[model samples]
Target: MTGSTRILVTGHNGYIGSVMVPLLQCAGYEVVGLDTGYFRGCTLGASTTSVPAISKDLRAIEPSDLAGIEAVIHLAALSNDPIGNLNPNWTREINAEGTVRLAEMAKAAGVRRFLFSSSCIMYGMSEASVVDETAPLAPQTEYARSKVVAEEALRAMADDRFSPVYCRNGTVYGFSPRMRFDTVLNNFMGSAFTTGRVEVHSDGTPWRPVVHVEDVARYFRLMLEAPRGDVHNEAFNMGVDSLNLQVREIAEIAAEAVPGAQLVLMPQPGADQRTYRADFTKFSRTFPNFEFRWTARKGAQDLYQALCSIALRHEDFTDKRFTRLRWLNHLLETRALDDNLHWQIEQQNVA
Candidate 1:
């Protein structure tokens, strides 16, 4: 690939996509954003920076859709545990199958680099342990399992024209133009503002590795430019070692960022079970000298400022529009799938 080669970013309007488009453009790379604009046409546009954009979904992607694209950065998906939990079948269809489809299309179009925005949550909240890339993956959610499947499928390609890189992102925190209110740190910060207390439904024992969204996007940019042979068929865990925090500690950071915000821990939710601290040495080994810049405190502070800037009230949280249950309800109401919306699978099928 030549300098300033064209790159196609799927989900280019998402939380990380919005930030990455500019970073790539500023670094002298031509960017083409491919998105269906699911988040209200909010995905980032090259028009905003030096890159141009194409509005298209993954399944309908044509050869022309990827014309002149040297790399494909795949980030499109339902994008949350609650969203995945909404309809596992829908999640599987979109996240797992859709990713493989994009990879096949990219390879067909002569694209050489493929970066998948994966989740470290695939490790499953392990009890009494730390996880590395080799850690026995015990994913507990449909979303995590889908990601694992996507990883295995794409990496199976192992072709010269098609290289797959997995960025196992930690508990992502921080601000984006397309800010997500559902994330742990962002949600906590949103709750902290003008609230009685930041409630940790969990007793705050589960360990979570954290990273700033912008930094995670930076990783994508780096992988996009990396040689096909360097990171191909490899998965890199993304996050700062210092940022592996408990829910309560994250709450503490949030409280500090938002003055007078109190953090209160409660009984743990049954659905929240992953608790392993991750060793990012694998990524460190892969990249060799690359360093992460954002810490949880800096990220939490940034998210707090963004949340406080919004004029929201306590009623918003309870409102169906902003709550998980209602969001899932609305998704199901779309009748996108005919299967049971609830987690109805037998334990055998789920694994």
Candidate 2:
């Protein structure tokens, strides 16, 4: 966890990873990136920091990829529910199987700390008001199921030599080089900023724990540096209790952040009602001094300002590059990627 510690961040070209790599580098950690280049050209305004990266698929990770790596921050996956629904097998293959494969390789290579980038979405439709780490995982979608399966597999792999810590992050928001308008808050912010309207398809009763991208990176760094005894083989719900907001509340915050944005709730039957309010008591207790800097309002304002600076248009907001499912579908339809989600043609260099 010192300045000399070399970290391997998978999916370094994605939303969170794009933000995370630069932060880690600025904090003095030697960072290496590994990504398949699915969202390679997906930059919002400015480009992310470039690092020495292995341009390889997650499922195709080789042992040499882990060579000289001290810790592994596993973020590569199908990434979202719609993409998971697109093909369950790909989610299982890459997120679940690929994670274990990479962990096994990291363990063999004498990598001490393995930080799994997990999600609280695995606590699907919990009856409990505030679910914690001990909450039963009821993954409704293939995406959530992949995280659950991968966490279980990683837990089993944790031993004296290999320490696996699961950072169960919430719905992450805020700006990144590889920006995503697919997540709830980010989606709402993008719509509010670009279209001057925040649209809610559901009744807006579903609850989601939202976290800022910067705070997520900082917390992961904390986990990486903390004593192994504290975080080893454990799962921490990565957000504060105050960050848990209902869909309507999030939309309101987003709408309020934009100058002329209106809030429209067109509740339809059978909308995505998956809701869970994560209890971050454990995270607070573990990282006592650590603070979540961004609130829903503040994050919304930040996104609004960033969008304003870039002069983001409705076309850019609806661009496939910023949305994972649409972009992957485009890749498949265009035959850039095969049916197996593997790149058929050579990938272009990430800008």
Candidate 3:
């Protein structure tokens, strides 16, 4: 393998990671995985590939774990608002502090490229027609706040050797070994497939930039391949302007994908109205040749087919393993993980 071939992808067992690890392997990179295996059981289909992984918590990631890794694609986190709302401190400790600690360890171990998986959700409820990398962060939820904090912390660590690139992704959709129905597009698609109804909880005017899991992996590869001068300490909003769509648009697409699936619009008080249209000019300019293969309609159709192929039932759609919040809540309620989100003694022994 080449010097830059040995890459460590944290959250390699999670949604994007499950898809990404195999893609990286096919591209001739020696990929090592780092995940706590919290959702290893959450499989929509058999995984395409596997890697030698460190079954360790992000908070406990030691310097030795970074020994042979050349680059780091950090993706492990509490994941979303509901989970973060479950315990804000858990998000703060794991997502924010753990990210800094891992980056610090990577820097000390001479890992050159640190690709931090960030979210466009941090541009919280912006009035700007199009929020870009230069837009002021107004993180509303603990989950979004953690990303902002992680990026800020990583920025301070960037230097001549340690180059950290933040890829602020739009809401990711499509099939993964570790599938999720928590994200907007995926949730709508799942509902359409399983229940024959795609429900829009809001007025459907909320704008969300949704990207495919494969595209996310592709961009991560591009980030790794880009020159040091081009990407060093840079932040790029992932996804194109064409991807930005209203909640109703996404639901309609999902409904269309699954024939006979009804679309229900129920705009209510205090519904999730978080909206933002991300400007992807920087990402477009940086990687002029890179193409995003999956559009919302295509992805929804693909997801519908995937769901149908699996014979996915309502029970499976509601399974705790596939939903991050429900899974985490199950772990917490069962005492598999303590209040701090650390594994209990019994689980620790197995890990």
Q: Whose lDDT is greatest here?
A: 2
Assess the local accuracy of residue 279 in candidate 3 as a C-alpha lDDT between 0 and 100: 96
TM-score rank order: 2, 3, 1
State the lDDT at 174 in candidate 1. 73
Misplaced by over 4 Å in model 1 are: 1-3, 41-51, 268-271, 308-351
Candidate 2 lDDT, 1-351, residue by residue in tens: 776799999999999999999989988999999999899988989777999999999888889999999999989888999989888999999999999999999999999999999999999999999899999999999999999999999999999999999999999999999999999999999898888899999999999999999999999999999999999999999989899999999999999999988999999998989999999999999889998899989988988889889999999999989999989988898888999999988777322
Of the two candidates 1 and 3, the one with more favorable TM-score, higher being better, is 3
Query: Which model is ahead, 1 or 2, in terms of lDDT?
Result: 2
Give the best candidate by TM-score: 2
The C-alpha stretches of model 2 lying farther than 4 A from their native spots are 349-351
lDDT assessment of candidate 1: 0.73
Per-residue accuracy of model 1 over 41-71 as CA lDDT, tens digit each: 2311123343467766566677778787888
